[model samples]
Target chain A: MEYQDPEDFIRDDSFLLYCSGKAPEATARWEQWLADNPGRRQDVMQARELVLYIQAELTDVAAASATFRQRLSPVSDLPAPVFPLWKKMLGVAAGLLLLAGSFGIWRYISTPDWLEVSTPLGAVKKVALPDGTQMWLNGGTTVKYIRKFRQSRQVVLEEGEVFFNVVHRADVPFEVRLPGGLQVQDIGTAFSVKSRQQISDELLLVQEGKVLLKKNEQHIQTLEKNEGISIEKGTMKTTAVKASPVSTSGWLTGTVALDNRSFSELGIALENTFQKRVIINGEQLKNRSITITFSRQDNLQQLLETLKLVYQITYEISGEQVIIK
Target chain B: MNNLSPEMDVLWERIRHDDAGAVVILYEKHYTDLLTYGIQLSKDLDYSKDLINDIFLHLWEKRRQLKPVANTRAYLFACLRRKFYQQTGNKTQVQYLEDELLQSISAQSIPSQEEMLIAIQHTTEIRQRVQQALSKLTGRQQQLIRMRYYDQLNYEQMEAATGIAVKTIYNTIYNAMKVLSAELKGVPVITLLLFYFEKR
Candidate 1:
């Protein structure tokens, strides 16, 4: 068969096989064709690129399939013996009791002790605490609370970020514990706390009312609405920054705002938001502060494009890694 | 081309004869394919996994009455597709499944800083472009591609399932690929393709 152009070559199964490095005969044939028709090298190259592109378009089914197989194996291994109606009814009754018992145990284990809610990368989970307070857990975040949260309203922001809309109760003050000996006691307020991985400083932004910041049981400072503070990891020194009342809880609405933050900060936020690595290569570039707000709906490509336009930077994405240049 | 390998054929026969071990093998062999196809149709991974489990359980329950299937993979795909369509009531909602699948796959990882950085740079635009390209294809052409590429079914097997002629299947896929290639032009297909192969 004589190939007319790149389109013709791309449409051929043998060309595809050669592109995928699957068929030796196809590769040999393609090599001979390329040798015979030196002028068509560009066409073949384009066609080969298209073939590889098409192959990549196919989903990576192996991981998902393996997970499915593991889940299905147990079901098939069990025998389905014919049971009498009465016996089946008895089994159902026993199963229900077992479920109830397990539920009781689970509640006992989870509540009054500690209930942890974690969100995966790029996901924001909205949870209602036992005390009717609303909490939005950002990606890669975990919020843990005692079972009797209403009676003892204390929660821990273990890692990542969380926004809270506290249910005001003069009798019981809501408290949030941060990593590295930092705490925020809400005085009837709406607030956000961010503690990223490997970052020594934790940020507290209060949207409404007031919060008293503390370090190792010692009062550090009190922050009001539209007020933000950063607590250093070791010294627990507080740096208060005056900012407009902007909701940094944008992940709830699929939007995130970066306000005059460095590239390293943006990298951490992007990593949490997309659940992917965002490596800023140069030290100078990493500290270059920029302010931007983007929607998650635009996806990573559009976000990268926007970044490229703003920063005049390029990026190369390998497997789960984005190297910025 | 029968979809079942010789081992699969023996397992299927044994399953029909009420061999529990054969049922396990059959489930193990086909569960992933069924779940993958189911997720594509259902747009819910957990739901798809459950649906697969239920289907296999039902299959085992009716094993004695099961007819010998020459192409078990095709048969299972048909079963899953039928079941999914019955549940979903609309096929046009498949556009979101791929995105959801990618998100779920990414969520499964707690990548290191470098890995996370790489992932952020990996553009979702390619998948979006692929979806757009797929949407441009005729329904029949799309179906043919799914059967050929996603399900990995041979032309004869697809013909047996969809009742479209084998020659027509080839023609449809050729035309579809041309359209997809054109549609995905100017996108960094080569770089992303290298990354994909490298990951594998």
Candidate 2:
């Protein structure tokens, strides 16, 4: 496809995509073409100018593209397990239903009294609670607390995982409420809470100090430093986590240790960390449990390489989905 | 409008099946076109941008529900244009578009690049000429031209220095270049930008 005129070049979609810097292949192709056909640089340059100015202010589209990318996050389910898209939708639907049901009362109290903080997929955020407790929220996690803190330091870990550094005030108890009528009351301790519907389990890991696990105000168990508890339905298991207290501060700075974890948990971890979904070929492979340690800096490709080496499995990354066999 | 060579059918299918990466690819491929169309319709960059973001977000959520369509670009354009008009509270799209296109076409004036570059060799005269020609342009166009010739600076540095967003700077300068295309048609943009900065 030789373009004799600048108008022809302008009419070419690949050339336009090239000028827009949208199509990667088009850019390389055009660059090669420009090098090969030195005679056409003048015409090409002219076409480029036409493309750039023809849209005027639109030449700044790269910025707009980035803005769009940001908009895709935390909601659009940008990667595998662009995860929790349906669950998030369900939550929104429930909220809307609640709003509709209390329409008359909702008008006066439009904004909720609780302040919610959410971290998008593949990102971690450190938040300072009103009670002086520092928290590192994992990706896809949402924590809500009262806007005006007065007495009790109560937080609701709505979804995902959270690592806490409680500002222990023995006079005022700190309580964390989660789904399934589960509650974690701290007597001033640093710990982490994790829950996922896909696994149908909740995990409580204590980094330092002690935390009391409760179900609907009923005492379940007390976990001390370096102690962890995994509760799945009616059954429970206690284990000493293979993690140091230093590693619990922040995921990026410290090693994230997953012990006796199942494939579903690994899938959730990868999806939340990298925004890429993990798809295993067989049911047995999908349910297989493995222990792994990784930091936030580790990428999905690197993990895939590790999987290939250890499991002797092959994989392919198609868009956001990571397929393992 | 340009027809995309990308197999939209394949992308459409993948997105419907909850392939999120497909959505990203689609967004990248059509962001510029949608932006150009949206801005042209609303004559408001910020509003057009916000609406574009909203529509894409909606697309991700509704990917499964969307009926199959033959023309993806047309479908996207229809979506954008409808939302654009709906939000602006105006349905007279055809007339408004025609008027805008006509006004742009009428403003299209071209000067010979060969002649412009042949005589202006001296720095002082080039500076004066550059100043004169640039004075004829609007403030936005002038700012955009400045953004263009500062190619040595990365987008981040330029964005930080000018307090302008990276997304918009590239876009406006192209429009400003289009404005320049009229004054010095067929000239390399870098050459005009050279003449521009020498003046500074």
Candidate 3:
């Protein structure tokens, strides 16, 4: 080997093998090479250390293995499959049949406990409850209720937005559950609920009747007609805003209005309307409030272009995310 | 990396013949490296771990019909990369990995006010030192180092892909390693090892 500098030693395959304690022959050859040139001992040590360091930097084999073993332990202990394909299929079919029979019996005996209705992205669906109350679900909204709706009219808003026109029933109160354990109890009136994953605030807008807002069993506020409140997670304070009729029910009529809302607020509104994630990138741009009104029929591209012209900002649409810069 | 060692080949043969002990040996041999590589690709430790476990479980399920793989490590890496790409829908930007490594280095060099505040609260001196050392290398040098060490591509393969001569590639790697070794001289090996392990 034509050994030159420390660089030459560092690049040598044999030297690396020796450094890793992998090849006895290479280790012997390197030892003899160093012995022949005693002055090269320090350089060889440095090269060896460098190789070891590089290898060490690549992975922590021991720690990774320990974690992996802990995860794999339970899986490896599972017994191997002994049944043939047809036997497994038969077993699965029998199990399913038994489950179905039991479920049918359970359903017949019980009141079926819960009913869930949901709308996909970019879709608005109108649903009529058993009690003749009407619900208009905005895009990507889910509403869950007990099957015994006549007894207690309580519905949970899983995500997105919904508007409810509750039939006046003085005996039973209608309650809508929002995220973060907030609830809106309707007092024989119509209201709208908007809670999207991307937006931090859960909004409740009263269009026709009065509703009592509760958080963790404590009464927060009583909202009346043409009134709305927004609740954030982990906060006791609710922001009250005077609601316009368009703000609550305009989506049903294919219109959207923003009254000097921040860019982030616009992002949330656009996300709800367009069924796409709107990411406001710049911190300053996120807080810059803008007022705009557009119809639900307007394409996202047109809306983004309008925003670009109005706000002097730029946006890039990548797959599902619209990045506002 | 060439393929299976003679010892690994023997184990693979036994695993193919329905040997549970051989399967265990194979799993033990490759799990850690696969996990580390998976974490690097996905940027999610728990997801990476789950994916790795799924791969192995899949292997066990289909062990009887499994084909002979010349290089099990390379095959595993390919499988992991494909699965990660499928799940994330992210085009793996080869250049971005190098840029991230470089940025981590520069970020260490000129600690932002926020980083300085974080450093006061947490002891991350070793990680900073290692990153600073890595930042000392040029982008090409860093890329080559990663391809050679982390990707485990041989010099000939690297030369073929990069159109650089084998000798020049060797020289570049050697020089990069020298710079890193010098910059990271005083740092404890244990600290460096732990840092690398922790990130993965």
lDDT of 2 by residue, A37-155 (tens): 98877677656644554443334565555545544544443333335566556445445644565322111111346766667666666555654456777777777887665466788
Q: Lowest lDDT 10-mer window, candidate 2 chain A?
A: A102-111
TM-score for the A chain of candidate 1: 0.62
True contacts kept of each: 0.12, 0.11, 0.07
* DockQ, Cα level, model 1: 0.08
* Backbone clashes under 3 angstroms, per model: 14, 14, 0
lDDT of each: 0.63, 0.60, 0.63
Better model by DockQ, 2 or 3? 2
Kindly report which residue stretches of model 1 are placed more than 4 angstroms away from their true locations once superposed.
Answer: A1-112, A243-247, A272-276, A282-284, A318-321, B1-200
TM-score of 1: 0.41
TM-score of each: 0.41, 0.41, 0.39
- Which has the better TM-score: candidate 1, or candidate 2? 1
Task: Tell me candidate 2's interface RMSD.
Answer: 15.1
Which candidate's DockQ is highest? 1
Write down the RMSD of candidate 3 (Cα, Å): 26.9
Better of 1 and 3 by TM-score: 1
Residue range A159-187, candidate 3, lDDT tens digits? 88888867555678778888778988877
For candidate 2, the TM-score is: 0.41
